[model samples]
Target: MPTVSDFIIERIREWGVTRVFGFPGDGIGAFDGALGRAERHDGGLEYIRPTHEEICALMATAHAKFTGEVGVCIATSSPGAFHLLNGLYDAQMDNQPVVAIVGQQGLASVGTFNQQESNLERVFADVAAYVQTITTPEQAEAVIDIAFRTAIARHQPTVVILPHDVQAMDAVTPGAEHWVSRSSVAAASAAITPPTEAIAHAAEIINAGEKVTFLVGAGATGATDEVLEAARLAGAGIITALRGKDVVPSDIPYHTQQLGLLGSLPSLHQIKRCDTIVLLGTNYPYGEFLPATGQARGIQVDIIPEHLGVRYPTELNLWGDVKATLTALIPLLRAKEDLGWQEKIAEEMRGWEREMLAQTEVTFETGANPRKVIHELNQRLPENAIVTADAGTTADWFGHHIRLRRGMRGDLSGRLATMLAAMPYAVAAKFAYSDRTVVCTIGDGAFQMLGMNELITVKKYLDRWENGRFIVVVMHNDDLAQVSWEMRTEDGNPLWEGSQDVQSVDYAGWAELLGFRGIRLHDDASVGAAMDEAFAHDGVTLIDAYVSKNVPPLPPHITVEYAKNTAKALLRGDPSELAVIRDSAAALVTEQVERVKGALHLGGRDDDGPR
Candidate 1:
């Protein structure tokens, strides 16, 4: 008879999970022993040990997000299991398939106040689609099967709790052969196609409108070609949610950038003008940016039926795989002949691009401008690069500036909006595709959160990272810049004392101490050289760029209320606040001036503006 640990490992391997991420702990000794045994044998799974459980969880989430496969992570009981919550929540919110295996105390110690004993099933219930604790060896295979099936089928996180003693018990062998087969696992996940009536109804809604817009999301990841074909047939402008930024290349004629808070003016303009909005695989939460309920007829397509019309009221809801639904609906849609709306949106997009270039050209007198750093990085980024960004001002610059090419991949915390995810995402992207170039853009505050220590994990695995180039660009602004901006602009309050401000660290020195190449950049002029140095370095590298904290990330469409709040905040007599407000106002004015110049045909070549 095989041990419970062996049975669990066999089932995971059978499900095509090749790697597991986590740290070691006493509660998981038996599971760790089984992992070692499996690794020693051919065709067995490998273990990726990150420095912290949170990093492990993040790596697993990134792996699933990038590969579209089930990402597996392991952890010990209590605090160790608790550490996985943040990253698991990222996976949950992003709708990625992730399975977390957590070790628990012995069954006999239940409610006995043991040192590492806690109810992990209850703790993970909110974040996981399925959460269960295995009490007996007989239930091992069944529980593991349910967890993997639920995660893959629902595209969400799943949890399996394993008690210490139960993991070492004799496994039930009666149905082991059936449970450990690849076909059995594959059968649990089947493809879904929308019904004929639903497809016809969606096509009818799209054909009735004069101006249609395709709003993409993470659900549209692998359906790019199909989505683009649909856009071409319908003469629709394409706008993506932040999670769907990589669905279509930025250079596409119909592509109008992203929407919502971290969105573009071109996208917002197109959304307002469109008569019919076709939501493809995205449940974009900001319904205000979309056409009002009665203004535009909406048609939503998604794999999950419940997500339909949750964001905006839809006239037709098509439930199925995005690619499959698009394939079926293409034949039913009447090809749009008039290209007037698409052309107009494209022209406005060009003007927006020119305005954006002008902002990138704006320089600070004291420190590096964060937008410029992102622009330079975007220019030098490899075609096959995998870029990840942390939340805050760093994401603000990256989301607005970085132009992801056809073959590139971009990852962020998405709905979770967590900080310190960029570094771990970069590491995991490198781990998943060792030959690709991976770059992570992070803020100074995010770097300090959990990124500072995780560098050691990158250094530890550097020798094994074959043909991969890892570059971390730290935008050191010396404070929680996003929070400060929110306080002044959103709340109409003065900057808080020391609560949101943080002391800057020698990030370059820290990188050097960890046995990686480190480059510190103090001026805007050094950005290109530092980027080159970091990329050329054989191992992991960090480019510590000192950026201006006074620079603000302006919204695409400024409102009267926002302008009033900003004026009141600036009047409170903080020099830095006043400087930021003045600079932002100037930038806005310059952008509007450039737009007006372009409209009057008084500017240079569209692409050869100020930058």
Candidate 2:
């Protein structure tokens, strides 16, 4: 007889779920037993086991982001189940569809303080949009159906808890009664668009201004043609939020890079100079970097109603899918004959590109500049490569140096801003598309936290992939670089060793121990060779890149007050003061030289340079 666990496996399969990320525990043994049976008898779900429950959920979220499907993860009750909170929060914050199936203590032990019997519903309430507990075999399929449907339709994480005994019960059919509802595996959604009059009004607002700019986010990922057409009609520059960095190709003349802290100087200048702002599919959350309230005419459109008009004081708000809305709004906009505004933005970007490369060229006595390390790797990224960046100074390099060409994919923890997600994200990408080369760029601090353990996961599955082009780049700086920068740049505080310093590890040595190719990135000269060797290898490779700890990730637009505060913090006996000042001086010199060369257009353009 089929068990409740078997029924669940079949139901999720019917829902088009092909992979499940999980870790085994005593409470979930029944499900494991059933998984074994399904694998032996019928072609069933692909079970991916991570080193821990947290990484399991993280892989599931990454799967959703890369594959555009509902991601599923399983965990045991109590501590194992609780560990999924952080990763679930990561999915929820990023608006990914994930369903977590966790085990609970037996129903007979309910409310009796049994081992690992704490209420999980209360814990998951905040992060999950839907949570349900299965008590009987008859109730299993219905709950699984709703869980997947809700997660996919809402683009939110959902939870399903199965009691120990319930998972082992013999499968039974629900009766034809009112409460005993049976469900199907079908999932459907419609393309949403706003009213015709509202779209016309939004176009009007966007058309009325002389200097217009489009601020796009993740929602605009597939609507590149529409975004470009709209920008062309309005003679506008396009600025992508961090989440939407890959939405449009960087080489587009008026396509300025990301906005805010990790963004480009061109993006900052464009935002400040624009008279009209078209906020589409982005809740960027940085008001200071946007046009001041009432400074620009705002037109916002988003599928989620609550997200509209929150970031800027928008004059027109339309609730619709970005592609459909833009498609409707395009015809209403009158094409502007003068392309001067866009040309100016394109020229500024041309200048910023030189400054970006020059930032990488600076020589540092302490270590290799991280920007240069990232830039070298960026240059080698294949046309179809997938890259993931962790949160830290590495993110600054990823944002500033890496430019996405057509057909390439890249992502990170954009909203939650969590650490230790990059490695798992890369792992999932490799698992989903084994034929594609996957790259993960992370810092040493995150590697020690959890990225190191995920290495074991990669080694375990080395034989499964069709191509073995997985590469992990570790920025080996012995400090929590981003937080350290925040303390000085945001609060004028010196580096606190207790909070910021992390002990150095021989990352490449560890990889060699795991029977994989590992190389130590010793100097600037070897950057290109190391990357070539890693990419050409037929096995997993690790590059332990030595990077400067004191190099600041300067924002695009630096204010005098910000400069004063940073100077004040470093001058107040900060441990890395001398190196920080040295690097800052090198950076300033690079900027000035590049600015002049860009003005003369004498450095000559490299078709290969990041746009």
Candidate 3:
């Protein structure tokens, strides 16, 4: 009685997908027909068309991360699938669960070089946990079911490509049944492995050492509580990379500091003082800061076996889930009763937090310090506001300054650090969780890369007058300073660092043209006023803050060695090593300038407009 399209929609319902994010084309014409029928039947599934396929995939990833459900995204044929690859790679690296359904050219076009022909299976092979092409209508239903389960079970992304001709064929009866509800679903605890005797032995090594440290990475996502428990028991100092900041707040008592190129002074100090280092769930790429082979015996633990010993030499490697391993080891390890060392570290952490907070105060009289604006935004935001951050300096700043409330969630480009994911993600976040406000903080450089195409989707949805959606806040500094700094040299040679002049582009005016209620803030005094106007406006709004071009964010986790080496590379004038050093120095310089400028500009310039 029903066509193949109806059967596919039924399967999607079974997978608990109520909304779909995608771009439709002729290859996916059957999806449109099916959507029309499903809407008439009150299926609750609606299609949202984003600007690019990559954005569509990222939106789904954000939705899944926020809601703990399988987020669905669709695309049409080869071009669409190719675009989806970048976002899917990001999701894979971040370990987010998502389902991507791509429409392929008709069966007749197979091996015939059709207009949109593509080897989608190969395209997604490296990025996806599961990639399959559904050829027949019968196989389509079965493979779709498998795709959903694989994506959810593994907490990984899966791609299903179907030919338009397959959906047009009519043979099998539609019999896919949906699970309306289920109780007592299992948590992802199985993925975590129990810690072996190595952890206990490693704790003994800590007991022997006068100074010990704990460094958490992005892989420690759900194990924050467990990691904290272990740290407290061992009386070991704690630190994390920027990606792991959300794992443990900077306010924690024993928190030493973060490590890496962007690490803080406190973290660098602790790294140097510690006699033993216990690495947890982090494969940090910068190996220069790590202790040499004999100095610090590194004990690394991770659920994924292949990731262990990739970055630094490991004295001991334990393969297991971070939370489970920590839980098992906590009981076996004895607490260090002496709190003198930990107390000192805690004092430094508190002092650092206080100093950073005070830096924003100096800029308050000048009207919106970006940091202060972020803090205020964090306060006014709803308890469950979902923030999607774009790549570059905006991500670094947001990671450090945008204090996360107990229930709030934030999504970024993950380990791959792709650009232009925030806008579409905000759009999808709105559709997935209308109860929560969605905010996108993007750098001017990153926004210019992908914001225009996404605005069309925003205008389309706003014309329909949807309520309680998303808003974008652009830090318009008018320069690709982040990249330029990476290319710069310490010697100030034009041939070394190249050009820093960014073309003067008015992003806010462009947003206005794209049908968003756009506002260009000319002074710091207008941040709150502009925010008020933005929230009150009906559809989408863009608040463009004219920020300092040279101000780069200094994350609370940068190290001195990293900083010194950066200086050396610049001083040496070695084009090879200098290229690497320039990025770190430029980042530090940018942040230092902002700190110094904020002090100098006290009560001088507004936070808006070019000085």
Candidate 4:
């Protein structure tokens, strides 16, 4: 008879899972043996082994984010299971579907102080939508089915603990008597659509507004045309959250890039001045950046009812598929004759674009400006590139730069806001879409934490990627840049050397050691040439750019409170205070100079300069 592990593997394949990320250990030796047999027989399943179990879990979440599929990860019991929590929680917070399978000490060993045995159900209680342990062969299929279904329906991670003995048992069918159940693979959930009345009410609110703005988030995926149609009818501008960067192409005239701390000036201007706002499938958490309560009449739409009307108070909340709901509402919205508001939005966006370009021209005495690095790289981004970023000033640069065409894909840990996930995310993106070019940016602090080892994993799979155009950019600043700035800006304190300062690593050299092309970038003049060389390479490459840590990631609209705190921080004797003031002054002056240049170029048929 075939072992239970064989049945489980077959069941997973039946569920349409083609890849699994994991690490090996004796606790999962039975399942590992089954995998070996499957491979021998050409089971069409691919197994990826990462340097650590944490990476396995992170890659699983990333796979789901990139492909919109249920990601699967496997690991051993005890310590391995413990390592999965960070990435599992990342999935839980970001609302991605992931399934984690872990091995356990045999069922008989439990409750006897057995080594490597603990109550896994309790351990996974907080992070999983569904957690189960198979006691017999008869229970395996039904439980596995439930785990997948629950993860998909809820967009959450689920767990399955397979004891050693249970894995070794022979596969058997459930009997007609005595608490036996059976299940088969099926669809996870039905698509949701709002009631006709709700859509009509939402349309009424938008029709009544004079100056309307739309906020789109990740939930707006596949609804780009509908969003554009609704905005065109209402004479509104569109603002995307960071997660929704690729939902709409950046070239659209009225599409304000992003809205939040890492947002553009036009996004802030439009949000502050608009008389009405429509929140479309975006759960943007920064409430302060949104219009004040009652400042604008609001309408919200989302597939998940729980996400509706939470970020901003809405006059109407419609629970439905974004594309379907927008399609329904589009017919009801009237085409506004006056294009004045959209024209103003377009003009402001032009000004912001010029001001942004001025920032990239800044240079420090010892380090290159990261803004310039990303700015040049953005000019060469492929239309179908898959981009990922870690949490830090890296995100600030990525959010402000890196404009994506419609077909391109990009994401980072949003709600979780975790560091060191960029490399794993890019690796998984390449695995899911091997033909697409994958580019990722990470800060030195995060790169040192886990990325050094993940490079080995990249080397192991270098020969497998169909396109082989993977590039990882590391910002080598020799400091915990984001946290150090946060201390100065948020806490009104100086940058403490004891905690914020860190040793820098030769990221490019490390990449070369792993048989990949590597470039060390420290000057602004070489950014464009370096990017061209890296992108043209056939295999993987790493760019280690030494960037200035003193360049502040300024908020789009600086408030009095923020300015006051920054002054206090500077007065507190920050070590990089002089560089901070110099860069800030130079950037502000340059932006003003560019704005003066943009004034004459706007409000006409002058498309003379690059947008």
Candidate 5:
């Protein structure tokens, strides 16, 4: 007679969960026996331990996002389950295929107010696409199957809550029959039978327009190639949301700029000039940025109907999978391979690219080009490098400029943008896949959030040094927050603002103190050499790059709302008006100098720096 834990582990294997990432707890220990048996039976299925459950979930998300498989994580009772929420939320928000197994307190304790017990299902309802608590033995297998299907089919995170009592009981035997077959997401028809006649009319308007633009969002991620093909077909320029940046590589010819609050000038300028704007799988947040004069015909393609007409007034809304819709529309549409349109948009893209490059120059002359260092490391590292970023200027810079090639796996804390996740995430990444190089990019501010505790966990893996060699790059910008400038009040009065000058600490010395190798890179030239050494060194190593704190957190885009906020701040800057003005002037001068220097192939500062 097999135990229910055996059945659960069998189901996990059948669902193709090779590695389970999580920290163990008392409630989950009952399944440990089954996990051991499953690992013995299936070579691919193993458990990977992390310092925290959030790291477990985040690591699973990265695995799922890259492999397109259902990433699995298991956590113990209430406290453990709660810890997994952040990573699960990230998975859900990013639409990554992931399934989390949460162990609840025994059913007898559900309402009795026992320790580590609550309605775990309700707690995770919003975080998971499908959430279920298993009290009956008969429902276990089906619940697991549904969880997998929900994650794999809809590309959303799913959760299965298992009470310790139910998990410990004798359940039905598990076998291959319990597994569901994997299926591809359905595609749309080649013949674009317009969802409505308005679609055709809008297409005609776009075909006739002199300047056309495409806004790509998450909806268009799957159809990136198709969308690009359509952009080429329609002779239009293209920009993407932050979510869609991964869809287009930096070298794409007609790629304009990313839009939103962080959007760039090329996208905004083109949006104003275009007579037709085709929204591909994107729901841009700012409707005001969208043309409203009725001169620009708006065509939208999205799988979700509710999103239609929400961001901007849609002249045509075609509901379907992004790739499917594009495939169908491409055949029905006339390819306007207009060289003039491409050239015009390309010119705008070039100008914005230059301006964008110029904005990063301030960090260079301030000395260490942290951005340039990261850029070089990104280029030099293996494509399969696993990079985890902590929130702050580090996360912002990487999100804006880090080029993620096909095999690279990058994970962030979604919009919550929590600090201290990088170290744990990098630890988990190393634990999850020993063959891949796992690197954590964190700011001095953020690195301290989870500081020495993470090192203890890394030390535990000393027996498996090959699998535990984690590389950490601490961007020491020497300010509490690198984006803020020192300020003074109006009439020469001082107002305390910005990160108080961060205390100087030798981060490398700290790492070395913890029995790990530490290297300090204070200049741009040494960054590459230090990282290479760190990567080659066995076990944990830290590369602390001292960067300038004066550089602004230049977003890819800025909106009218942001400008208005700036104006308000300016008007209210009675305490530090002069300093704020000086900071603005300095930023402008840096931008101008870099713009001129870049074109002439002479550089004054290495401004394209990172944290």
Candidate 6:
């Protein structure tokens, strides 16, 4: 007779989950045994063991993000399950489909305060779209099926809590036939199409305006062609939220880069100038960057009805799948002939790209410019590279500088905005697509936080990765650079004494100790060679590139509040801070001059200059 654990594994395998990431403990011994039995079979789920439970959750989330498949993770009771919260929240906020299976203490110990006892359901409630605890063997299969279905359909995290005793019980065998066939599963969950009236209303709102801007978000991930077609039909300039950065290729003439704080000047200009804004599959949280309530008419298209008009006041809300809605609306849209506005925005983007290139060209006196390092990495990155960035200044440089090709995929902690996710994301990406190169750009502080220990996990899995390069680029500034910058520039305070500054560690040496190639690059001259070495290596590699902490993540447009704060900070700061600001100012001036020259076709070449 099959045990409850065996039934659960069978259901998961049938649902096409190839791998489960987590740590095993006493509470999950029965489930682990079932996993072992399955692995002996021909095509069974592989259990990936990460050193930390948090990383396990992160890996599962990234796996789903990259493959568009439901990612699964498991953890033991209490502390093990608690550790998965951070990564589970990443999946929840980012809207990735993931299912977390957490083991709980035996039912007998529920009220006795036994070891590792806690209410797993309550712990995961907020981070999951659905949470269920299986008390009996008969409930196991049903709950697992529902969890998987809910996670995939809603594109959110779901949790199934399995107590120790229940997992060990004998499952009530159903009729000899399969419990649920694949055909039944497919029929139960089908794509939703918007009503004709809703689609027509959205079309009317979009057609009414002379200048329309399409803001794509994560919801438009697989509907790139449809989005581009819609943009072309409306004669619109396309701008993506950070989560939707990979939705539209940067090389496309009509597409502007990401919008908001880490956005380009051209995108901000397009947003401000457009008479109408069409939001597709993206609930962009920043309303300040969007057109005001009465200034521009808004049309929002999303799968979830509740999210409609929640971000911006919309005249029409088309609730449906992005691709399906666009497919139906295309015939209704009158093809726009006026390319004048789009052309203007394209020119602005060209100028901004030139400015960015010039900034990347500027070298620091001591260490390598972080922008230059990112630019070089971008140049050499493979067309199909899976890039991940930590939340901080590293993500700032990545969002602005790293251009994604048509086949490339990348993401950061968009809504969660948590640190120490880059490395775990890379590991997950590599596991999902072993044939593709995986690169993670992380800040020094973030790397030290949780990424340092995860390196051993990478080392453990190095041999298992068949055909991919795993590279971790540490933006080493020896401090919490982003927080320090915020303190100085936003709060008008000098760098706090011991709180903001961190002692420098030999990260490359640490990488070497963990059985991976470690390379440290201090200047621009060695950057290319270091990158080449890291990419060419067969096993895992870490590049600890020392960068300047003084260079701020300056936005596309500088505001008056920022200027006043910067002025206050400079006045109150020491001589060193003054010198740093002076150097940065000089670099900015040079970058502006280059931008002007490029715009006028005077000096710099039009093409992306040599790496």
Q: How close is candidate 1 to the true structure, as a TM-score?
A: 0.95
Which 10-residue span in candidate 3 carries the lowest summed lDDT? 179-188
Candidate 4 per-residue lDDT over residues 289-341, each given as its tens digit: 99988889999888777888888878888888789888888999999999888
Question: Can you write out model 3's per-residue Cα lDDT over 271-362, one digit (the tens) per residue?
Answer: 76677788887766677677666777677877667778887776778887777778777776678888776876775555555555654443
> What TM-score does structure 3 among the candidates reach?
0.80
* Per-prediction TM-score: 0.95, 0.96, 0.80, 0.96, 0.80, 0.94
lDDT of 6 by residue, 467-582 (tens): 74788999998878888777766888777657876678999999999878899999888889999998888778899999887777878776788777877777886334765676
Q: Where in model 4 is the C-alpha error above 4 Å?
A: 595-611
lDDT string for model 2 (251-363, tens) is 89888889888898778878877899998788898888999887789988887777888988888888888899999989999999888889878987988887998888898
Better of 1 and 6 by TM-score: 1
Candidate 5 minimal-lDDT segment of 10 residues: 485-494
Ranking by TM-score: 2, 4, 1, 6, 5, 3
Q: Hey, what RMSD does candidate 6 come out at?
A: 4.0
CA lDDT for candidate 1: 0.84
Residue pairs in collision within model 2? none
Indicate the residue-level lDDT of 334 in model 4.
94
lDDT scores of the candidates, listed in order: 0.84, 0.88, 0.69, 0.88, 0.69, 0.84
lDDT of 3 at 528: 78
Give the C-alpha miss distance for residue 349 in model 2, angstroms: 0.5
Summarize candidate 1's per-residue lDDT along 250-305 as a digit string, tens digits. 88976877886667877887787789999988878887788977889998888877
Q: Which residue ranges in model 5 land beyond 4 Å of their true spot?
A: 173-206, 261-263, 283-295, 304-306, 356-370, 378-388, 404-411, 421-439, 451-471, 478-505, 513-517, 528-541, 555-584, 593-611
